[model samples]
Target: MSSKQPDTGRLTEPCEGYLVTPPLLEAASFADRLDHALTVLPVAAVRLRLAETSPETMKRTILDIREIMDRHDAALMLDGFPELVRQTGCDGAHVEAEDVAAARKILGDDFQLGAACGFSRDLAMLAGEKGADYVAFGPFGAEPETEGLALLTWWREMMELPVVAAYSPASEMADLPLPEMLHTLAATADFLALGVTQDGHSFDALWQTPEKFLPLFAETAKD
Candidate 1:
């Protein structure tokens, strides 16, 4: 290593909230939740996810959510569906670290591209190198855990690329309305992705936006 500390940058924007839609995609219901969320939360983007849904429902859902997203000026990112990004009117695609290069080729340079490098520094680095617009590091959908916090701190200090502190349940910290762990993340990350919601912490049960996490963004603004 060089004697001189190499200059590395971190996310300048105070961490903004990011939404990952629940597994089910029902156009009308989700649109309402999303609109409500946009009005209240400082959401930087929304990741559309489909666990089980028909093709018709998928298209309609995408169109419905797209309208709300455009109105809010929040990006509509399709999770793990680079192929459908343009066809479905999505603003971008968030894929696994391994898919970063291929997804970039598919989406090209204009659209936003994010990679989920859950708990793996090596994967995060590879994703950044492969043209991911932003690399997300965390426990993804896992239960509440604290291991991910250390990873976020490391990335913030050592990397110039944008980092997202993926959300976890609020069981770790005590006597706090919102998860104290989440508030700690605001200092370092660029975006905070909503994960499994704990009781008294949920934004909308159907949407899983995490109401308590709103305070950080509510108090501050993001560019």
Candidate 2:
């Protein structure tokens, strides 16, 4: 909650949204690749992995991402550790359902803590009760593609927590080709949780979708 720090959290009411490019262990070169995408997108934040190869190696990757965020004025989101969240100066931490209470206790009131709520309204409510800054609603229950839209709608109405809808391309590849997917995705909720598969992580691939979708998203958002 350092007001002095730039607000790099995801762009949502309860939480800020970022286009998180997950960390890659083998692809040390991927940082720049991901950074390039963040540069083009109107991303509020970026989520980078906390590779646990070794303490020293982890530190190096964290530093690299921090430098990228610093240059972009973007916030960093970590799934590695709460300690790393504080140490790396990331804006927030995303924790699984079982870990939410513990993470909340660890992060305290200052940090942004987002939780995975599955597809249950009770789960989302529990996350809110435990002080989650926002709640993500997938990678489970209904499939992450077409069925996910219904789940997001459910979460939005049933739970007060800000919602994120996550989708893996393999599971949702058919939907990706449809312009309505982008339009409905942008219109549906506060944040869109797109998965970065082996192929989709590329700048050409990722940007291709957005280049087509942003204009469509703008038109849809107006209507």
Candidate 3:
């Protein structure tokens, strides 16, 4: 692991959180839940990922959540929808590694463009070179990859672009607390992009009660 510290210039605090939309975001009720989450948690960004739906439906879904995100001052990043970013009034777009350059052209310099690089350093570097605002590293899954951590450590130590340590829990680890998982990731990642899908876990509980997990972020900063 790299000894150098991750950059905190863009964040209000030393460590910050980012939220990933649940798979089923088209539901009207989910927007309310998202509003509650953002209202309570210190989240800087929200990646809106939706299942395949009609263009009209997608726009409506984004519009519903956009208001809440805007009120909270959280950047709403549309997943794989660079073209619709401006039309939908989104803050930015998150694209795959292969589409970084195209997305950048579509979004221009002012918008926040992020890239999902998976575990490839070459792709991550390429995204950065192509003017990505940040690079996301992994799903990391139940068995976290040493290489993924190394990549995050290296990116944090060397790059100015932010790094999001993403986690999508495997079936075996669904029972673990979200905060507990976040605590482990906070050691190396500047931002945590957590999937809101843990079994028996409530998003309300995670955000409303900061005492349970927010301190873990503060603790990581000290290290």
Candidate 4:
């Protein structure tokens, strides 16, 4: 891995969070949840990952979140729906690492294309080489703080493209608190990707519920 640092000549922004919506969504309700999340964290982007839906439904979901995304100035992204990216006027699409090349071709050069590499460096390299704007690393299981954190650190040293520290929908495990992962990867990742909510609790509880953590995240937002 290369030890060279990234080139940031201007005032560098701190690592930003990215929210991934639930696989199944009721546009309006999910939008409300998403709006609440944006208020808590310094989100830079939001991804809509659908399970199986018609084009119209997908478009509506995008339309609902569009307002909040625009309000927060966060880029809007679709998961595995490169074609809809332009159709819905989203900022980008996140595809399997192997599909980066083909997706890039379809979307052309202007739109952002992120790769879902699921903890594989080789896959990440493949996607990055194929013109992916960024690569996401994990929805890690137990022991993520050690294994996952180590991976993000290694990736920061090795790549210049932004890296996202991703979490699975059931991300808030007892031993795995969001803040610990966020705090540990603050210097390494460009975005922290996770579901909008966990169980019945809102996303804010993951970071915002704790009053003490607010100051730390607020400081990051100012940067």
For each candidate in turn, the TM-score is 0.81, 0.74, 0.81, 0.80
lDDT of 1 by residue, 78-110 (tens): 887787787887888999999999999998987
**True-vs-predicted CA distance for residue 52, candidate 3, Å:** 1.6
Quantify all predictions' global Cα lDDT against the true fold: 0.71, 0.59, 0.72, 0.69
Q: Give the clash total for candidate 3.
A: 0
Q: Write the per-residue lDDT of candidate 2 for residues 1-223, one digit (tens) a residue.
A: 1122212333223322346565545335765656665555555556665545876677677777777777775667776487777776678788876677888787888788877777666777788888887777764222236566787766665554667655334432443454455445556566665535434342234534544434423422211
lDDT tens digits by residue: candidate 3, 1-223 = 1122444543333556678876544758676667766665557788888767898988888898887776885788888989889999988899997899999999998788989999999999999999888889887765657788788877777787788888666443423365344565676677777645444133444434434455646633222
Q: Clashing residue pairs in candidate 4, if any?
A: none
Candidate 3 — worst ten consecutive residues by lDDT sum? 1-10
Off by over 4 Å in 1: 1-13, 140-147, 170-176, 195-211, 218-223
Local accuracy of candidate 4 as per-residue lDDT tens digits, 1-223: 1112466531143566677776755477666667766776667788777757777887887777777777776788888889988888899899999999999999999899999898788899999999998989886433446766777777776668778877544444443344454555555676666554435233444443433333435545533
Each model's total of backbone clashes: 1, 5, 0, 0
* Global Cα lDDT for candidate 4: 0.69
TM-score of 4: 0.80
Q: Per-residue error at 68 for model 3, in Å?
A: 1.1
Question: lDDT winner among the candidates?
Answer: 3
lDDT of 1 at 190: 74
Flag clash pairs in model 3.
none
Error of 4 at 27 (Å): 1.0
